[model samples]
Target: MAKTWFITGASKGFGREWAEAALERGDSVVGTARNPDDVQALVDQYPDTFLAIRLDVTDRAADVAAVQQAAEHFGRLDVVVNNAGFGHFGMVEELTEDEVRAQLETNFFGALWVTQAALPIMREQGSGHVVQVSSIGGISAFPTVGAYHASKWALEGLSQSLSQEVAGFGIHVTLVEPGGFSTDWSGPSSKHSEELDAYADVREAASKRPSASDPGKPEATRSAILKVVDAEQPPLRVFFGKAPLGIAERDYESRLATWREWQPVAEEAHGA
Candidate 1:
């Protein structure tokens, strides 16, 4: 059976690639972007199978409306991809309150609203997939991108809980964490905080990281996404690029070591 997909940020990057992949494979897709014009080409290319919706994911009401409209148009939504978020580059101390709020509103709350909107429908249908576009930053912290990391980390925790909650309802939740995709996420689509002269050295070090210099091609992830959505038992978390696995391994090892080293201290807190 052909699946129906509602993908946010369908105008570019992984969203665009995944949407076109599904459409090309005879699936139905409702693609949303802030500007409908950005995705109009897809609508034109696949008139019957593609829908372009104007959506600002941060708008809670509009997100609900878009999800509802997708279900109505397609008769059912088989997949919901919350891929509409941008990277915020700022040192923790350099970030302003508004910048932080804007980062959280779009990257964290945006996905939350869409997931909430899609759940009832998926629950009623007894089957669906919700794919959250998280990042490698979700699990690890780095300089100059603290706000982005915070947003993704929040999403990571939320999706983890959501997966366990929704499993019995036959709704699958997956967090797609990519390691530096060759998208505008760190380029044109990225937001930056006002720089502090004190952090110049930190900024330089951050800019020279592997993620800044090398990024996987965005189009290469289409097939992987298709496989994930089509799987009978999809993973709760999946990494889209080569870098994430190594990063995860190193991070987890360090974390385990630290935790183990502090096990006595942690146990002492029980006052036993």
Candidate 2:
């Protein structure tokens, strides 16, 4: 069956590649980006199958409208991918309050709004998939990318709660944690929070070429999605790349050990 797909940040990166992959598989796509013109060319190529929407996920109303438009355009939406996000790099003290919110708005709250809007349509239809384009940072943290990591970690927590909340209702939520890709994540698609003078040295260090934190291959990422989409049951989290695999593995081991070390204290608190 040709499923209908709603994807944000479709102008570039995984969003664009995923939309293209879905369309190539005969599905319908409503693609959105902050700059809608990057998608104009795609819409022209796949007139009957594509609808390009202009949206900035930080804008609540605009986010809701984009999701609603996708549902309405396709008569029913089968999948909604919240892929709009920004990377704000710098020491925490260097970022302004607005810059921090802007990062969370597009990365965390943006996905929240999209999922909320899509839920009604999916619930009405009785089945649907909600995919969040989170990052490997969702599972771990690094120095310069603290802002980006915080947003992704919050998303991970949200996904944990949402997975259980929506399970019995027939809706599924999946989070993609990519290591790094050839996407513009290292280039224009990414953003950096400015220095507050106190962290001038930190900002300068982060601006260096080797300071980029993204690590997923675009083609491999697209392929991973296709591979898992049709599986009998997809996992709540999919971590892409050798780097993430290693990091996630080590993180799990360390956390598990810590938890066991404190098991008696935890049990006492729970009266177990």
Top candidate by TM-score:
1
Q: What shift in Å separates residue 164 of candidate 1 from its native position after superposition?
A: 0.8
Each model's TM-score?
0.99, 0.90
Looking at model 2, the pairs that clash are 179-215, 180-215, 180-216, 181-215, 181-216
How high is the CA lDDT of each candidate model? 0.94, 0.84
Query: Can you give the lDDT of residue 121 in candidate 2?
Result: 88
Cα lDDT tens digits for candidate 2, 228-249: 5665578899876767788888
Instruction: Name the regions of candidate 2 deviating beyond 4 angstroms.
Output: 196-215, 264-272
User: What is the TM-score (0 to 1) of candidate 1?
Assistant: 0.99
Q: lDDT per residue, candidate 1, 82-155, as tens digits?
A: 99999888899989999999999999999999999999999999999999999888998888888999999999
Candidate 1 Cα outliers beyond 4 Å, as residue runs? none
C-alpha lDDT of residue 23 in model 2: 87
